[model samples]
Target: MSDTTTPEQLADDAVVVDVREQDEWDAGHAPGAIHIPLGELPARLDELPEADERDPLPIICRSGNRSGKAVAWLTQQGFDAANVEGGMKQWAFAGKPVVTDSGADPQVI
Candidate 1:
């Protein structure tokens, strides 16, 4: 099983990758998270940190399913990765910062 990290456990400098679709991302996502849909990750491997990096890549989806899969895949690829348990839904529920392209209040889509 993929390792998991809670939203509350994330550090300020952690690399957070959102694996939701473009439309979902445009709706809302964690502030400072890198937008890379799950389907695009294979081609966009360079956009992520090097496999040898000490910091783990914390990934999230609308809920946590997709990101859990991503974490499993990433770990197999030699990268330190973890799923963000509870995902964006929990982040927003925890009153964490979120942003959207529309300049409206952020909501999990």
Candidate 2:
């Protein structure tokens, strides 16, 4: 059996970093994910909690490209960061829950 976690395994306790631009974030993103936009990450490293330094931190973007770079950077910075496999697009395609400003706010179970 594969030990890989599904989107269902994601929780508030897991650190999910969104590295897209502010415009992208304002649109929609993984619920509970921390927005650190790639441009500011280098200078904003301190804002990330110490727990993320040791625990798994999943970096995400609209697609996986930017987050891949983020994963590399964070790993180099001594943080345990990983790319969110296929990013939000995959999450959405997989029928995972997402938050959007489409009038009614649906809850993710």
Candidate 3:
């Protein structure tokens, strides 16, 4: 099984990849997280930051399900990746900062 990490366990400087759809991502996401919908991930793999076993890439979505699948695919492609358990919902619940493209307040969709 792939590794699963909770939002609270994330490092402040960790580079996070958000794999939700565009609409979901525009709704809200972790500050500074990269936006790459799951469907586009294969085509956009090069856009992701470099990662390794010691520093696995963090992938998240509205819920853990999508991110988990992403982690599986990424790992197969030789990327060290982990799924964010409970995803954006848990991240927001953990008091992590969420942001939007607009200046409006952010909330997980």
Candidate 4:
């Protein structure tokens, strides 16, 4: 089965990868999340931590759809990845930290 994680349950050391497009990512994203648009994932594999590192890799998008696909692909490649259920929407609703490129108020786009 595909691995999945909730925003509230994300681990402290987990590596968060935001797979939204540039416009969406610029609006708001988890602080420190790696910005790798889903379309660029295949070419950006090197940006992800190695599977042996054992740190959880939580993939997120505007909602959960894209991240779920990413989780499936990454898992197939042997990385310990999981879909961030409900994605940024749930994260913001749960009061999780978010940041914007211009220091403006964060919003899910």
| Best TM-score among the predictions, by candidate number | 3
Clash count for candidate 2 is 0
Q: Which residue pairs in model 4 clash with each other?
A: none
- Looking at candidate 2, what is the lDDT of residue 26? 65
Query: Mind giving the per-residue lDDT tens digits that candidate 4 earns over 8-51?
Result: 88743346999999989988888858999999998999998654
With candidate 2 superimposed using the best TM-score fit, by how many Å does residue 72's alpha carbon deviate from the native? 0.5
* Per-residue lDDT over 44-72 for candidate 2, one digit per residue giving the tens place of the 0 to 100 score: 99887554443477787876788888888
Q: Between candidates 2 and 3, which one is better according to TM-score?
A: 3
Of the pair 1 and 3, which is ahead by TM-score? 3
Q: What is the Cα-based lDDT of residue 36 in candidate 2?
A: 96
lDDT, model 2, position 14: 52
Give Cα distance to truth, residue 31, candidate 2, Å.
Answer: 1.2
Error of 1 at 81 (Å): 0.1
lDDT of 4 at 18: 92
- The candidate that wins on lDDT is 3
Model 1 lDDT tens row, 9-87: 8754456999999989988888778999999999998998553355577899988999998999998988888899999
Give Cα distance to truth, residue 97, candidate 3, Å: 0.4
> Global lDDT for candidate 4?
0.85
How many clashes would you count in candidate 4? 0
The whole-model C-alpha lDDT of candidate 3 against the native structure comes to: 0.88
Q: Model 3, which residues run further than 4 Å from truth?
A: none
User: What is candidate 1's local distance difference test score?
Assistant: 0.85
Counting clashing residue pairs in each candidate, in order, gives: 0, 0, 0, 0
